[model samples]
Target: MTADARPSLAALSAPLVARLIDDAPALRLGIERVGGARVVDAGIRHPGGLEAGRRIAELCMGGLGRATLGAVPGTAAWPFGVTVHSAQPVLACLASQYAGWSLSHGDFFALGSGPGRALARQEALFDELGYTNAADNAAFVLEVDKPPPAELVAHIASTCAIAPDNLTLVLTPTQSLAGTVQVVARVLEVALHKVHALGFPLDRVVDGIGMAPLPPPGGGFLTAMGRTNDAILYGGTVQLHVTGPDVEAEELANRLPSSASRDHGRPFAEVFAAVKGDFYAIDSMLFSPARVTVTALDSGHSFHAGTLAPELVERSFTHVP
Candidate 1:
């Protein structure tokens, strides 16, 4: 697909951004102007909760998807969960929601995710997806405790070819309520990312749905990050509909789970610590949903792989002491 033929993620998500700003008080999100950009505080100063995160997750997908809170059937310890679905999985999950754009300046560092990323085209992934956006406004989701520096904000606006005031920066802290939900909400995105990493043809993916148990917010950053990761690595499930040969769909199902990674057996925090906190050192394959089902749309055959590890999820969620 050509970049010109794709839908503008920023344009599609504009209504979501407006809804977020309009419902800021009810959602407990703090709205302010920082570095001339509209910053939506999902957790930093506001008491943003699960609903706020759910909405933010939709925004993260450029409003091409839906995220809902629900119960995890057959689960007791962790009953709450988030389910996500996207019809345009490649554009929504990869081009917008994947957190592919890395932004940093001084000691401040953040991975920018959302519709604005389509406008900037900073990451090489956009090239693979053959997508670009032309919009008057852009919105970005940054998982951080503090506002971005003025220089960094200016850089983001400049790269997106928009004025600072036309930019919206959403901050979601790792240890906050909104943070945990938003992070876990990436279950489908994780599966889509793993599919890309496995060299599967992105154009074959037609639709996808994923869900993961929502763990309680951890007391600190490390613990919080671990629980969120474990939720997907152990407790998550994904189903992808694709137009492809049954054998290819089967192979994709087999390779698209966290269990296929060399770094799979333990909690992510342990893996992180073993790697000395070097994210690059960890196995890229370990960041996928625990279980997956790939259905070949043309053949009407479904292939399944991996299993949920409730024990590991329980261990990670309870290890916060």
Candidate 2:
């Protein structure tokens, strides 16, 4: 946590780090430059950036065309481009966790200060097939854009050489934020899911979406997958939170899990800490699953894609060399 301090990977939150494999097509990565050096709003303005959900899903499932396209009108560009000196810290940290998934030249901020370029190779194949996964993908816009025009969408699809159906548009605002930063945050979250759902097998498509309006189990907002108790993308920043036993409770007990020991990873304690965590983790790990798992643990409980709150879960760590 110091200028001269160098932390190992284990010191970093697992959800906060990710990797992009060259072979996996289901995980198309999308990144756009924004206004801030640190936490500035620099999303794709022109042609906007790739839809987060769409690009990643395309990368994961395959059968999609090129992952990104555009520079079209109304989409704002980072005129001054990115400030590397300003973003050096996050850039370094993100590069470490997401090195493989990142563009070859460096971070998206690198894309600015010049014409845009696809950082990753254009055409690659996956070696694992089904296990194909993606890590460290991010898309950020200062102010969200509306869905591009039809022609623009077609052009983007053409640029990527994919059909219109295969594409999901990044949104823009015709109006103003009106102090509606919270709404922007919620929409950003929903956008991550809807687009990702496009790549799911037909039977699994239901898992790809949900707004937060409907009352969730126990009337909660954080529903699983596409189901939620409230309309997401509302008028406030939405913070995704999770904390559980690192290893299964049973497994922990077998070791030092004496019932008398303290719950170092209590959900309440973790949630309280999460409440204070900055957008650093909020932006990158909200939708990511590495830190927590989602399982439809109960078959009888019908989830229009229902999710079991990770709070009910526990974890155990095993050392392996």
Consecutive 10-residue window with the lowest summed lDDT within model 1: 71-80
Cα deviation of 116, candidate 1, in Å: 0.4
Distance (Å) between predicted and true CA of 194, model 2? 12
Candidate lDDT (C-alpha), each: 0.92, 0.22
The estimated TM-scores of all candidates read 0.98, 0.22
Model 1 lDDT per residue over 115-216, tens place: 899889988887787776888899999999999999999999999999999999999999888989889999999999988888999999999999999998
Q: Residue 39 lDDT in model 2?
A: 19
Error of 2 at 192 (Å): 7.7
Write down the TM-score for model 1: 0.98
Q: Candidate 2 residues 200-246, lDDT tens each?
A: 21112122111122111111112121121111211111111112332
Task: Judge candidate 1 against the unseen true structure and give its global Cα lDDT, from 0 to 1.
Answer: 0.92
The candidate maximizing TM-score is: 1
